[model samples]
Target: MNNKNKRLVIPLLGAPGVKLTDTTLKENLSDPFVQFKTLYKIVERFNPDGIFPFMDLTVEAEALGLKIEFPENDNPSVREHPVKNRDALNEIKRKWKGVSERMITFIKVCEMMAKEFNILKGGYVIGPFTLAGELVGVNDLGINVIEDPDFVEEVVDFTTSVIFEYAKALLETGIDMIAVLEPTAVILSPQQFREFSMKHFKHLSSELKKPVIYHICGNTKHLIEDMGKSGAWGLSLDSAVDLKWASEIVPSDVRLIGNLDPVKVFLQGNPEMIYEKTKELLEKMRDVDNFILSSGCDIPLGTPLENIDAFMQAAKSFK
Candidate 1:
């Protein structure tokens, strides 16, 4: 509720250049020192007052044995489906390397930044169900969920344990909070959300001991209340969502972040359009002390710098 504690402030993020994308393999992203140092430079310049890096998740799905393919210019996208069936999916156990290349790089990134910046530094972990989906293919995971709820639960729980150790590694770096990117949670029904996503997150929430933010990047208006109960300190909605409405609907104690249409406004639109949307978002959030302005998701790779600058001007225009 205190915007002054920029640590508590939720500002904007990007997919790659704008937000940290999980674009590396275990080999590349693990050493986040240089990358994080670069990120800190951006944070220092942007001066969002607080900092939340690009949501990067390397260990969660990797430990489960999914092969990741890193692209040259863009963020890493998931490449392989490791789990052949329910049996193969449930074979995973917790194999944690909090300080692996991608993992430790990000960890050290957080540690060094936390020490130097007084920034509310933190990174992301892919949630269990999504991780499971990445490993087992979304369609396959869904099929398993219907045919083998208990089997799916086991994998989900196993995936969550990996996220737990992965998160602790980030915290060990002395980061402020954890952003649990639950991107795939959007595909589940309310019932499925409870069965798979909710329990898995609640388990992590119980163990993490720091402020946790839950983000599902889609029309999750139906799941907002359910999401609020997950014990996260904040809730970040995508650009397709309405931030003011989320503020009204979500409990006051839980901070609300985002809803900026990153692509339509920031990437493709002109500065005036960006400025107008910026002003409109600021006005919408004027009365609310707990909201942070941000793009619906990460800034696309090609977004103009000036469009993002307009949002910064809007943030500084607090009076």
Candidate 2:
């Protein structure tokens, strides 16, 4: 999407940074020093066309006062859903100051990455529906969507405001792109996705005026049409999607950035196998110019470094 390279190679890389730097996920996430070191090591080793910080979805939710549990090795998870009603959400809004320290830590890391790296630097923000799910719990949100549509709209609107502010902070650091993590919206029907997620995504992408990469995990083939209309410059899809098939449906200008199975191709397979799989994907997409080869999602922790090398080599060597 950046157009700096004919075939850009940027995996949704994060947890692997911890594994590469010999630091725990908690340490790298909390301290910008640890965060920068991990990312810098990744760039040095992999030489990716673009680089992004750890894709921790909990940053925005935790900042909004949700209970979060952080494990040493694994990514953090939201533990408490305190907003049971409209009044509860209003209370949190009334007391809101700004983003928390961890959010600032990520922004600071972006600043550091901006100063040090010449390649494209990216930032992450949790999508509106996903953050709302964290606040009210996914089950209640789903039920309210059908039974109480107005309430669901109000909650989503509030979450969008919160995300907009956070996105502005990330953009201030001079990052090239922001990927909105909207994994929760994967379960919604196409119409529901357009109504709830697409509307707010358009707002963020338009207001920021930066290349927004819409990233949703799992099989997103059902929602491709709405996602293409969300004003995103690119779509970062998961392994379940067929990139060759999606390339036909997605808009001509929008770049496609994934499909390689992170676990199967990068983690479980050896280098030779990884090379063949990466090459296979490359061959399928050779006719499409707006394509960036990447892992379907974030490369899992404990993935072998050599396998990553094979993926990069395959992309670079392809005609």
Candidate 3:
């Protein structure tokens, strides 16, 4: 699609009111029918150009035998790092079953969304580096990347294999696009990002039949150019990024999809405030033809529907 003329507003709205609440995530995610109904409700309420099925980053880790704790109000989070040593990592790789793992339920949801929803259907996978962090613990992974570069590479390589298989399955389900969430890569320098994350991302992007949107939270000012080199069709940025600066540096072909503060603007603001903020952002990015107005990241739980409505209205009214 020509994003230049379309003005797409594809905010990440996987919070309680729009999608499934925490109470429903465990019960609903496992059941395709319930997941479809939940996703349909989100599509109906938001009327977005696309539907982003459950943004839980823990799905990949959980599939690798890591334990996850589902909180009452928040997204599920990984509770353990099963691959603590080389032996453990090798064991995981040996036993890894892509389609039959815990993530199968999520793949089924994507299939349901693709077949049932008329709008663009999108699926998400935690980026390989990020999934590696879940498996080995972020702190340990960081230290190991410097103290034991070989070990880090091996772990990330295994994760790349896991993500590739999982992404391939999602694509087979007919989703229009896939989003790779690489929040862990935000801590790496540009060169480190290229070596550890971008390479694997390029592999995924090249292999996937559908377009890939790469997202990294926090300030990506240093990595914008490198991020464009990852072969993704679009780059989803966080609120810490300056869209104008990013637009200037990143290649024009890579569509830019964010920077709106999900918490301050969507969760706390009133409709009028939300509309004004939306208009402000629209004006800031007006010159960037490939820009798609979106929340910097997933809209948090309890964000007001009226605020979201105002955001859409402002985008629609922008001349």
Candidate 4:
């Protein structure tokens, strides 16, 4: 973490590397060599202060035996949610082995990045509630949260255990930080988020030795206080959040990592638009030393390279 007045720029910009290289999204995820090459090209192009490999929420679910669809052009997605009841949950847990081969593929990528890049390197894991949503269908997970809160806890507990095994492998690769992606938690009320999502993260943060960045998609203003209390080193929020407001709510010691609109400002806007947007965000958080300049979420594939360039230049030029 940059403790000085200078803010760090760590955009979540991995998928676009496929456009720069001769690889597809599916290939980059499965083949370590291809994945490394794609990300290497991204680093060579932007040269950010820190980098994380592609953000894949399906890795753990697919590793746990759930079917997944890996698109050639886009991110992989869970194809089926099999855990409908306690018996199904028990069945999956009973058959559960350790992390799968593709899981190792990502860990290998981390190792390559750690040995290759001198700057801060990070890894990601699907957060407990999100993984639970994958196993038990998101619709069912939502209903269960209210109707069968106990069952939801049981499922989340299992998912948390699964994440522990995968996260340990990532940590062993010498990465500097881990971002727990909990996009599904956005639908829950603040109290529900604390009970179902935040507690498990507390346990997770206590166990992992590295800094944990609690990343949740969409507007998380309602849940920011609980998110701040999850023992994570930082909060990577989405474009909908007001980062300046978040900085005031979260503790001064915790780093604040984003709020830039990845789509409207980076993917859709031109270079000048991006520069101004990035400059505006930088200006708002100027007095906050713990702020890190970044996109609200992973910069979507096909975003113009010049847009990214503008973002970096704006951050670098800021005092």
Q: How many backbone clashes can be found in candidate 1?
A: 14
Off by over 4 Å in 1: 4-9, 14-30, 57-59, 94-101
Q: Write the per-residue lDDT of candidate 4 for residues 1-319, one digit (tens) a residue.
A: 5848568999998887888886788888889889999889989989899999998889999888989888888888999999989999999999889988688999999999999999999999999999999999999999999999999999999999999889989989999989999999999999999999999999888899789999999989899998888898999999999988988899988889987898888889999989899899999999988888899999988888889999999989988
Candidate 3 per-residue lDDT, tens place, 16-70, comes to 4434333455565456666667777767777888878767888888778788897
Q: lDDT by residue for model 1 over 1-319, one digit each (tens)?
A: 3556442334555333333333332223544654665566567556665676555544556555567666554666678877765556545443444435456556776777788876566678888898888877888888888887787787787778778888888887777888888888898888899889988788888889988888898899778878878888888789777778878778888888786887888789887787788788877787877786767776766777677777777666645
lDDT of 2: 0.89
TM-scores for all candidates: the values are 0.89, 0.97, 0.95, 0.98
Q: Which stretches of candidate 2 lie above 4 Å from their native place?
A: 1-5
Better structure of 3 and 4 per TM-score? 4
Candidate 4, residue 34: how far the Cα is off, in Å = 0.6
> Residue 4, candidate 4: how far off, in angstroms?
0.4
| Candidate order by decreasing lDDT | 4, 2, 3, 1
lDDT of each: 0.72, 0.89, 0.84, 0.91
Candidate 1 at 163: error in angstroms? 0.3
> Stretches of candidate 4 above 4 Å error?
none
Residue 306 error, candidate 2, Å: 1.4
RMSD of 4: 0.9
Candidate number of the best TM-score:
4
Identify the leading candidate in terms of lDDT: 4
